[model samples]
Target: MLIAHLSDLHIRPQGMLYQGLVDSNTMCEQAIAHLNKLLPRPDVVIITGDLVDEGLPQEYAMARELLAGIEQPLLMIPGNHDDRTLMGSTFSQPYLSSTAGPWHFVADDLGPVRIIGVDVTVPLEHHGDMTEAAGAWLDAALAQEPTRPTLVMLHQPPFLSGIPYIDTYACRNSERLREVVQRYPAIERVVCGHIHRSMQLRFGGTVLCTAPSTTTAIGLALDAEAEEASYVEPPALLLHHWKVDTGLITHWVPIGTFRGPLPFA
Candidate 1:
């Protein structure tokens, strides 16, 4: 099974731009079109979050129209820039039936794989947290089907990226999130988006991957003295392919023009 992972759309109005420069909407359109044209279409597509530049009804409206192109089963969760109410109302599905809490955790079986999504958004705050109730909900969900090859997805990554600007907004209760995940060996990967860059690391016995922005990407500045910065780097999304005999693997696919797939000699 193949899964397409996209995040931090930062979608905005037709003429509007993000951070006063990036044209995210056009980038998202190109990414969706790219997904539609893949030879073996992905089994599932999950956008990790930040669906809109601002969590406005109009923004959601415009985003919904663009996202209609995706042919695969697409799943999404809340990000710091997302408003749960606005998102849920516009993109409601059977999987998002929860009403009482900020957690929108749900599990879907896809024959050889099970995709589980959870909400880690802190209201009106850029930082992320997994509440006690959300944690219990996840633990119970995983307990139900512990052996399935599950792919857990959330907005903020539990581990920190080297960039100080992004790390400050990472998941606060990381240990709680870790406890639930480490107990379930079936979880293959904890995929997330929020930093607007591609990063991966092993944490709590599982591989954690952070997707790059579908539009713009923050440069990789690993030095302690490096100042925070972002740029209009080549936009891209992630593809997680599950091989029964070999296990799961990830690929970062850029969303733009490239040379032809010439025949090998």
Candidate 2:
């Protein structure tokens, strides 16, 4: 099974620019086109969150329209920038449990992988927390299909990336979540977004990785006092190819056309 992972779309109202500079909408359209042209189409697409810039009805409408271009099954969870209720209403699908509090669900029908999406966003806040209830939910979900190849996805990463600015609002109480994940050996990967740039870290007993945004990338500043900034870096996405022998292998694919396929000398 091939899974295409996209994150931090930050779609704005049609014609509006993200942060009044980058054309996130247009870039997202390009990313979608990039996905559609893949040689072996992805079996499923999982978006980690921040689907819109602001939690507005218009933004959700635009997000819905833009995401409609995807040709494969889609699963999404909320990020700090998203309004759970509004997003649930806009992209109603069976994978989502409801159009209400804490959008979390399990999808077992998508190919050979079991996808468990956990919502850790604190409503109207920038930080995320894996509450005791949410942890219990995840524990039970994993128990249901103990032996299935599983992928757990959330918005904010459970581990701290060295970037100091974003880490201030990073997922809190993640140790609890990590403990739960450690017990479940079937989890192939814990994928996330929100950091903008691609990152990978070892967490629990599995690999945790973050995808680059389809729009702007948060500047990579490791200094303790560095100011927050974004750059128009090459937008990209992640593809995870899974097979019995190979397990799961990820590829970082940059968006847009580039000359290639030249024979090696």
Candidate 3:
């Protein structure tokens, strides 16, 4: 099964770009249109977070309408720029029956794969945290048998990406998140999105990948010693393909066309 992993749309009014610089809405529109034209449409669309620049009701309303056009099942979580209560109330569809828990944790079974999503937004904080409640919920979810090849999706990454600005606001209790993953051997990959850059790291023996946002990306400044590092980069997303017989393979597909279409067939 193929899954489209997208994040950080940061949708806002047409004229309202972050700090009056980036045109994120246009980027999001381009990404969605490209997604619609993929040869094998994604089995699911997992948006890690930062759905809005400011967690406003109007922003969420606009995002809700834009994403509603997707043809596949969609999942989401909250990032630093999102309001948990508002997000929960806005997107309310479950993969299973309504008897399951609320909007915090969502799980969907796609044939031989099980995709589980968790929200880690900390109210009023720019950083994110995987609370004790969320850990316990994950533990319980992992305990279930008939565990198909599992993929855990969240907003903030549990591991550092060698960048100070992004690491400072990453998942606070990463060890707790890792411990739970170690317990669940079925977990094949832990995918996340808040970094706004494509990255790969190892956590609890599972492959941890951070997908770049569909909006503007913060450049890789792992070595820059400046107080605040910044750079402009292309927006991108991830396409993750999982096979029960084989394993999970993810491709970082950058949105928008570049200068060339080199024919390599």
Q: What is the TM-score of each candidate against the true structure?
A: 0.95, 0.98, 0.91
Please rank every candidate by lDDT, starting with the best: 2, 1, 3
CA-lDDT, candidates in order: 0.86, 0.92, 0.79
- Which rank order by TM-score, best down to worst? 2, 1, 3
User: Model 3, 172-264: lDDT tens per residue?
Assistant: 898989999988777888988888888897889788998887776776777646355444577778998887667889999977777766777
- For model 2, what is the C-alpha lDDT against the true structure? 0.92
Question: Candidate 1 or 2, higher lDDT?
Answer: 2
- Model number with the top TM-score: 2
Alpha-carbon runs more than 4 Å astray in model 2: none
- How far residue 59's Cα lies from its native spot in candidate 3, in Å, is 1.0
The root-mean-square deviation over C-alpha atoms between each candidate and the true structure, in angstroms, is 1.5, 1.0, 2.5
Which pairs clash in the backbone of model 1?
none
- Clash list (residue pairs), candidate 3: none
